[model samples]
Target: IELAEVVREVTKAENKPFKPMYDWGDRVEDKIFSVANKIYGAEAVDYTATAKKDLARIYELGFDKLPVCIAKTHKSLSDNPHLLGRPKDFLVTVREIIINSGAGFLVPLTGDIIRMPGLPAVPRATVIDIDDDGNIVGLE
Candidate 1:
């Protein structure tokens, strides 16, 4: 669904509109959702019927305070970046689900993706340095 639509639903449920946020390349982690919205043509997509119904039920069960976890690929919006823009007949294979009691939420792992990512072979830290005085410097 469109980002605006998702925000609207959340607002209707929570009684307030959630602020919009976007992250460009600087923060790779935060931009995936925006990319999804762009790829899916905003408002053209929706969560799986089963997932949506489950979320609604959870909300009805006095779980408004609980967290919402979006299960998606850690890769590009197309699930496979090689194929861009709203892909049809694509299948998201969810391997497992985990519940975080402390966090009061459910995690639906949709694919083999890493939450904690490791740097590439040439680490950015290689060029970073901290002096004895605590001053820091890195690639410009």
Candidate 2:
């Protein structure tokens, strides 16, 4: 039943149009800020000012045409992960955009993305054990 539900969700998503968070524009910074204002009623600031010299150095090396990876919370469309289930009347605050020219992507630090995957309240490792007969036990 769980597998069926998962398949159903995958099918639904597959049929949906690919709507990007930010639209394409002459400047990536402008596009991001505009999209943020339109959708989340907030501003997207370019926190990359500190790395201006480094960025200029990279640009001079000629690796500017790379895709961006916006690092946002998967739990919610808004920056606040606590706002669940298609929340309305909310704002998304974009703090920074980190450019990884070598990796070929700009990581936009929106809200907070969990860089590390966390263990559940009661981790399965606690329950999972090897039986005396050498069979795995305690997993549904």
Candidate 3:
């Protein structure tokens, strides 16, 4: 609820239209690269060629107005995951943009992002167990 209010405030403050999804289209990659370069001195590589065919196919199907969801490491604003904790001196290299037409978002592949979420070293499921009385236990 707080997030929703914040979004409302931000939208009103910015005076931007509240679109369900934002579509930057072909210029999305360049725009992001420019911003990164300005802010962090990072360089974004263009690997759109690899996904060119797929993107073209998506466009052919007429789903070109979808907003891009950039897939990058949360560890750093830059693409490099190892460069954690707001390091400013690094290049952000974008390898490709994977299109999810059905989901209506373009995933910009940056650095070494593992698309799959990995399990913790000690998974909680392992620690979770049931008591002899059938009550749930070990779920702190």
Candidate 4:
């Protein structure tokens, strides 16, 4: 998607105006990449490799077979961590799986999931201080 955006920008600057190039069609890849960027660096290791390591580690712990719980964004293949800024392409892959008995769900520890959350402009915290004389004052 970033590549496509670049192509579009280049075309516009050159007075060509290309429709834009998309591998998976539309801007899905771009959106996914954006999310991953927010969670991890653009050059972070592949998710598949991470997943495989997790599976091996879990198996070594004496856990039997379990369901697979993908931690990536269900909306897209990539995780959602980056903000609105453009993101680079980072391939994602799965490695292993484990069952979470406590939660009654399969915990498939994938490479990683970068979750960038939205915050309120105004924080909901107030600071107050009191002196030995019992004089209270507001803190900023």
Candidate 5:
């Protein structure tokens, strides 16, 4: 069966809805601060020199109104991976801001987090099948 069909058969979802955490229309910097504070329990936000420059460029480009997606550590609520659980009284230092205008969102790189682009599992070369006559099937 297909994945969706299997999911439907295995679990009965209530289709319950939850409200959005913050309004997407809010300022990009405000959104970053809000996420750092509300979700991670950060006391304050400190932007690095590079991050400040990045933010300035973003604002100058009129991208300050864009939504923000903070890249932080997954091991903890805070930026540091060592601080597990709901950490509080910590400062979130934004290292840099990456503008993805096409995707319609700004990504703020927090702490020492490295931004890794999502890649597909199957390589295109693996799909290139050949028959006994040596005719390629998926070269395109």
Candidate 6:
């Protein structure tokens, strides 16, 4: 179904917004450990040498104050994508961390993850065209 069709056919849509549940305190290391170990139920969190250096840089740059946006595979709860379902025992290995101060968040790169490209059956760009008046159309 199209976005509009799905919206129109939706039975119940809650107004409740997301609220962060777990917090291991203000430290960046604590934040990552909190997300990986506490939330994802990881037995432990292993940080790579690059990640260690990144953390040091982040702290030096004072971007460590920002919230963490952990990047991991959608295929599994753990960082390992091939783990499937909810694996009982696993480690969340943070390969590297990058900060976008303008965006105000720290992205901790975990495992081998890729961006989610939402390719639809009918691409929205295919329907987009310029009207007679030179205004864009089919954007909605």
Each candidate's lDDT (Cα)?
Answer: 0.49, 0.62, 0.66, 0.48, 0.85, 0.83
Model 5 poorest 10 in a row by lDDT: 9-18
Once all C-alphas are superposed, what RMSD does model 5 give against the true structure? 6.7
Cα displacement (angstroms), candidate 5, residue 97, comes to 0.2
TM-score of each: 0.34, 0.44, 0.51, 0.30, 0.70, 0.65
Task: Estimate, for each residue in 28-135, the C-alpha lDDT of model 3 and write its tens digit.
Answer: 545455556665456444554655665566567765556666678877777876776666657665667677766867676777787987588998888789899998
Judged by lDDT, which candidate is best?
Answer: 5
In terms of TM-score, which candidate is strongest? Answer: 5
Candidate 5 lDDT over 80-124, as tens digits, reads 899987789898989999999999989999878987866779878
TM-score of 3: 0.51
How many pairs collide in each candidate, listed in order?
Answer: 2, 0, 0, 8, 0, 0
Give me the displacement of residue 54 in model 3, in angstroms.
4.0
> Where does model 5 exceed 4 Å of error?
1-25, 118-123, 126-140
Sort order, TM-score high to low: 5, 6, 3, 2, 1, 4
Tell me the tens digit of each residue's lDDT in model 2 across 9-91: 99898998877655442255555555556655553444445435544553566544445555778877667788887666565
Residue ranges of candidate 2 with Cα displaced over 4 Å:
1-25, 34-65, 116-140
Clashing residue pairs found in predicted model 2: none
Candidate 3 Cα outliers beyond 4 Å, as residue runs: 1-43, 85-90, 117-140
Candidate with the larger TM-score of 1 and 4 = 1
Candidate 4 lDDT tens digits, 22-66 = 232323224333334555335443436555565466557544333
Residue-level lDDT tens digits of model 6 in 44-118: 888999999999999898787799999998888899878887686588999999887888899998998765665
CA shift at 62, candidate 4, in angstroms? 3.0
Which is the better candidate, 4 or 6, if ranked by lDDT?
Answer: 6
